[model samples]
Target: METIIREDTPKTPYVKLDGEKGVVEIKGRSIPENSVEFYKPLIDWIDEYGDDPKDNTIINIQLEYFNTSSSKCILDIFKKLELLFKKGFKVQVNWYYEEDDEDMFEAGEDYQSIINLPFKMIEMEE
Candidate 1:
């Protein structure tokens, strides 16, 4: 599958979904006017990628901040990943939060608790 890349904007995150490499990355702020619309293609791409996913899939999430609507969209992405994990493919999510950012850390923990996929909370220097 072709790689999907979206540059980060003031109100959206940078996204790179490489099916061939089995790597996904999302970074920056995500408070789009229409969260669902902004993330629909991404979710759809994951669905398509699921048909013939790589043996090992990794998603790196490094968001500085996100609004409530974006949070739901993020969860949808995780749910999609959860399905892939259940199918027996090796999947992991690396959630990166800036040092001293308690809220971000807790957000990662929240997603970790809800999703069955393995999650690694990474602390990054501010």
Candidate 2:
């Protein structure tokens, strides 16, 4: 499986999917004009990874902000991860938020509540 690495842009987030380690990360802001275009490959990658997953699969989400469309896409990502968990794969989602960012923290909590995977909410100093 190939890794997916995309640098952050003004209207998008930074994505780093390490296939070898089974760790995927999405950071920065995500308010892209076309959410589908931005997240299609990511969803596909997750699907493929889930098929032949590693012992441990961790998804690290550290977004400052995201639009409604991006929110749906994020949910889709979590759903895919849940599938991996159902297949007996070790899956975890590390949701990172700034210390004072209540909205981000709550968003992470919402996702945790919906997904069956082990979701850890992490508070970062920054």
Best by lDDT: 1
Residue pairs in candidate 2 whose N, alpha carbon or C atoms collide under 3 angstroms: none
Off by over 4 Å in 1: none
Candidate 1 displacement at residue 64 in angstroms: 0.5
* Candidate 1 residue lDDT tens string, 1-126: 999999999999999999999999999999998999999999999999999999999999999999999999999999998999998999999999999999999999999888899999999997
Candidate number achieving the greatest TM-score relative to the actual structure: 1
Query: What are the per-residue Cα lDDT tens digits for candidate 2 across 16-70?
Result: 9898999999999999889999999999999898878899999999999999899
Clashes of each: 0, 0
